[model samples]
Target chain A: MKCNAETIGLMHKYLDGDITTEEEQQLKYHLEDCEACQEHFRELKRTLTLIQSAERFEAPANFTANVMKNLPTEKKQVKYLRWFKMHPMLTAAAVFFILMFTGVFFTWEQDNQLVVSKQENLIIEGDTVIVPEGEVVEGDLLVKNGNLIINGTVDGNVTLVNGKLIDDDPLDNRGLMASVGEINGEFESVDQTFDWILYKLKGFAKKVFSFE
Target chain B: MEQIIREKIILVKKGDQSAYEDLVSFYQNKIYQHCYRMLGNAHEAEDIAQEAFIRAYVNIHSFDEKRKFSSWLYRIATNLSIDRLRKRKPDYFLDAEVKGTDGLDMYSQLQSEGASLVEEVENNELQRYIHTKISELPPKYRSIIILRYLEEFSLKEISEILDIPIGTVKTRIHRGREALRKRLRHV
Candidate 1:
């Protein structure tokens, strides 16, 4: 087998002993007869040796010290990280998500009984219960197979199916309260009742405090 | 269980300055040689070598006990040198590997020693040419050439350092060397 430019090109790595056993054999077989490739191989080897043996420069007297002087403070931080490591964003986001999750969970736990009672009332009433504005129902709700009219707010889902509702935005009913058939009326404004109650409570609180 | 090496590693990792110094002293020559060969400059090589040791000192925790420590150190030095080459490419090719002021045949002057000197000078020039041509090769091939020639690392050592298959290292080295030789032939 004759060695060509391609084979001779590989001769540098070959001479450096970087060639594979198979490649070594192939190169060896080719070089056994191919004088030009063999010569190229030897030259390449000599070059690698001369290059490796060439004089090397040493670092300046204070090279390491200089590097140390400019060393990043992150060295201390990497070790610190090994001991306790977490990304700031991930940590903050984790805290936020945990707080959010826990907030929902705790609220569900505290107000669960009220929600249950409202659900029971709806089931028991089993018919349209007209709730006047500013009226508060302190029991669970269950609107069974019937329409609920909201002249005011029922503290829970006002379910209706094939029933008429005489309010503006009727699609606000969604989420964990889906057991109710449907809802009627724009109850978004119904949230103001809390402010109204706080107003009355403030008056009562003021009257009570005034006596003190 | 190479107790001496094991103890040295343990001491260095424990932040023992003396142990670290001992390790530095032991490998400084080879490390400098690696950087010098890669960068074709003594001063830069020396700085890179020193920085490599410092890095080793800081990252000793990541070193696996079963592997050779010098190989790891050499890897860092080589990478640093290559990075320097990339940053200073235009200036690097112009450095002082050429002949004297007269630009007389440097090869002949080097060859006065003997016919062997011819190959030696040629090889030196060839390897020097490799420094410039190497940048043109793929990074993987470039790394193999640097490791094999500049660091004189064995195929197995390179495989260990790079965590690649030894066969792959062989192929890349072979291919990379061929590419270099071809490139030099044209020059």
Candidate 2:
């Protein structure tokens, strides 16, 4: 029996136990007659047996204990979720209050720099705001975190926060139509978001009933 | 015993965490060996085996009752080992074997039952040579070969554990065997 291509394949199938009975018979006959195929089969067997006989290692003795110790319990997170599920309304109220508190603190902290209105006509010389002489300011003028030196006529209200007014238009409003009608101190208006909300609400109530 | 294991799995699924100890104890050594065979490093094998058990415990609810648990755990460990191999740099391919293989002693701590088997090769020197040679195969062939021969899994079991088709598994085993045979012939 001559070893052909199919017989060569048969040798592999024979090793893996995939050959038919007829194929096995044919391969065995060829192996018996052919010395080359015989050596090939031996080498293949040796290779496989070498790997199989390699050592199986043992895990450390503390392996099981360590795994058990590190097993994170699903119960604690589940219980926390169950509690939230049980009191949905309370949870919602808590979330709402938390959002509101954080919103206020964030706005207060972020509004740290000086914010001056009517920036077009104002000359900022360091921390002092100079309304240059003879320039008539049109809207309500406000200064934050700095001093106001009003050298010009403010046609509307004047407000300053955290600093005194260095000077104002000398004309008095009680006797005539003075250009600076309102020079309010630090206690005048709200600047932060939370304060803005309160100021708007109080203004609404004052207009509805409390005003003269 | 199978029913007891299934019950323990069910308890774990129901959030009874302590019942998982029995499952871990039963499969620890086998999982460690599977990882060791795939990775070729004992320390990584131990760590990955522990990770496999932890992942199984975490995902107990998703495990199907109809499927065998050991196959599932093997799949997890095999995937983890492959990931570890893929993350390795190209330079460490041969360097790791040189540095890390010194502590490996095949004969020192064998189980009594496995020590005297007829399949145990007689030459310890040849065993060490083939052990290093096995690491030279790519992860794909290395893995299928390990599952097929070292662990003695059926072709279908290898398919399930690797999530590949059975025909693919068969082809890879042949190629892996051919590659190993050629490597051994060179020496």
Candidate 3:
């Protein structure tokens, strides 16, 4: 028997068990006649059988336990990412609050308009604010980009930024002189802006995270 | 068995450590045998097989539930074996026990079909010889031959495990068999 390419190919397919019945018949016919191809197929089978019947190694008894023990602990950042993936709504809400806070904070910082605390009892005239005489200012008063006239008793500290302090009598019983920040130029304004941003962010954090 | 594997997979995906332990425990011997054949060293086989399980657990989220878990696992073990083979220094396998087949008891290896004791001993020696030859083959042929013969994986499954086309798998199997045959015939 010639045992040409087709016979050899058929033999391989038959050995691998991938041939159809029709092709199987053709290979069976060929192997019956071809002595050389039969010897070749026998060696292949011998090799495969020796390999299949070879000795095997088993894992150590502690393999699974060791695997479980050696598993890398999930990093905090990965847990946060997975948590955020599970809760997109909360992630979006956090992102929204952050953007809004950033926008409002910077805009308020850049604004040159007068910003005063405890506006109820204070008298405003143009850029000057006067705490009326005998009026008790309840809490700390903050004046920015304005003139502050001290006439009444302020129970808390007075913080003045980008403003002037005018004492009516320049005498006793006035509000205690606290830290004063006078914005002289752009550098001073930037410094005041950072301080104001920090103050607002601190208060905002308290309000928001207090629930948490 | 399939139900147990599925249940363990679900539990493992849900971050249950014991479930993962059960899963690894189920496949450990098979995986260790695979690594041992690919690497031809017990210590490296144990290390690489354990590494494969740890990797599978760490990447559990990326694993699709629809595929065969064993195939995924064998892929990891195969790749780790390949990496280790690539990084191996010459003479590293000198310490590997090529005659390690003696570790198995002959009585336990006896087949139900009666065969002469002399023939059984010769066959055992031949199998051990072939095993050593297999470990010496290049990584590419060694892996495909092991998948085809020892593991009895179909060509499609081997293709999936090696991430190659079925045609490539068939060609490699053919050539791998030829290489082993030539060396075998010389002896």
Q: Quick one: best DockQ, which candidate?
A: 2
Q: List the residue pairs that clash in candidate 2.
A: none
lDDT of 3 by residue, A14-75 (tens): 77778899998887787788788788888877767666766666798888888888997644
- In the range A96-157, model 1's lDDT, one tens digit per residue, is 76885566446434532212224322222334455544455543344323345544445544
Residue by residue across B1-187, what tens digits does model 1's lDDT show? Answer: 3678779888666655555656666677677766765665445666678778878878889999787888898778767876877787455343335422465343543445356446666556555455556556776787777677666778899987777899888778767765665665544
lDDT-wise, the better of 1 and 2 is 2
Better of 1 and 2 by TM-score: 2
Pairs with backbone N, CA or C atoms under 3 Å apart (clashes), candidate 3:
none
Write down the TM-score of model 1's second chain: 0.66
lDDT tens readout by residue for model 2, B77-178: 999999988876767543234333475343432433246543555555566567667777888898888888877788889999999998888788888988
The superposed Cα distance between candidate 2 and the true structure at residue B21, in angstroms, equals: 1.6
Alpha-carbon error at B113 in model 3, in Å? 31
Best by lDDT: 3
DockQ of 1: 0.12
Which docking category, incorrect, acceptable, medium or high, applies to candidate 1?
incorrect
Q: Which stretches of candidate 3 lie over 4 Å from their true place?
A: A1-4, A20-22, A74-212, B91-124, B185-187
DockQ of each: 0.12, 0.36, 0.35
The per-residue C-alpha lDDT of model 3 at residue A86 equals 82
Residue A43's lDDT within candidate 2 is 83
Model 3 agreement with the true structure over B16-123: per-residue lDDT tens digits: 666787888889999999999999866679889999999999998888877889999999999999999988777644334433355543343343213543666665
